[model samples]
Target: MAKIDIRRPHSLSVADARSIVDRVAERMREKFGTDSQWSGDTLTFQRSGVKGAIAVVPGEVHVTAELGMLLSPLKGTIEDEIGRKLDEHFA
Candidate 1:
């Protein structure tokens, strides 16, 4: 198994930050068949081989995920993709 954890700081308003996350989540849902839900300030997501939460707080977005055995080898690539997305959307 592999774990990914990322934290990015942003200056956008809470609503705006969440909207960005939602947009990202929508794309993930379409491409990966991920199912997600929001609980307070966190968006939780899961698919066959991955599960994670994106927590949007006052000035930070923290993403954490665990990958199953089949997907473990792609951890670095996945982390880079998340970083790129965070940079694209939150930077």
Candidate 2:
């Protein structure tokens, strides 16, 4: 599996961070129609044979996504999309 991870620090409070994470996870679920679960500081989603996790820390957020197929061509697009969303939601 190919893994992609993104991490960044934000100025929002923990509650706000959690909210942002939830919102992002919801968006991903809606768009991809994936099987997902959120518990405490981590949200994980699996769809189209790909699995992803979004973890929120005290002042930082980390996203780890793994592709289960052999489509290496799509990895960059996936990483860019996740990074863009994180920037938009967290900034």
Candidate 3:
């Protein structure tokens, strides 16, 4: 398994950060059939080969995921896509 850990500092409020994360979750669900839910400030998401959480804090957003063996090889691509999304949303 491969792990993806991305942290980005943001100026948005917790609520706003959550909104962005929710949008991201929705896209993931629509595109990849992911299952996601919110537990306070964290949004946890999972699918067959991926599992992750987006945590919204006062000044930052942290994304962490574990990829199954089959998906491990594409880790860089996945991470880059995520970074692009984060840049679009928060940067």
Candidate 4:
């Protein structure tokens, strides 16, 4: 599996961060056929093709994504899509 991580510093409160993560996770789940859940500062996702978690701490948000071996050939596309979504959310 290939792991991709994105880190951003934001001024959002814990609750707001959680909400954003939850929303983003849901969107990702629907679009990518993944399972996602949020717990406090962490949002985790698992699917046959990929798995990962997003961790939010204080003023920082970290997104980590792992692509399965079967999907390794599309790693660049996957990473680019994730980066785009993160940019949309943080912007």
Return the top candidate by lDDT: 1
lDDT of 1: 0.96
TM-score between candidate 1 and the true structure = 0.98
Clash tally for model 3? 0
* Residue range 1-91, candidate 4, lDDT tens digits: 7778888777888678778888877776787788887676788889897888899898878888788798888988877887787677765
Per-model TM-score versus the true fold: 0.98, 0.88, 0.98, 0.85
Off by over 4 Å in 1: none
> Candidate 3's residue-wise lDDT over 1-91, tens digit each?
9999999999999999999899989999999999999999999999999999999999999999999999999999999999999999999
The reply for model 3, stretches above 4 Å from the true place, is: none
All candidates' lDDT scores?
Answer: 0.96, 0.82, 0.95, 0.80
lDDT of 2 by residue, 19-66 (tens): 888777787678878888877878888888688888888889888888
Q: Which candidate model has the greater lDDT, 1 or 4? A: 1
- Predicted candidate 4, C-alpha RMSD: 1.5
Model 4: clashing residue pairs? Answer: none
Two-way TM-score contest, 2 vs 3, winner: 3
Supply the TM-score for candidate 3: 0.98
Report how far off residue 3 is in candidate 3 (Å): 0.2
Task: Give per-residue lDDT, candidate 3, residue 33.
Answer: 99
Candidate 1, residue 53: Cα displacement in angstroms equals 0.3
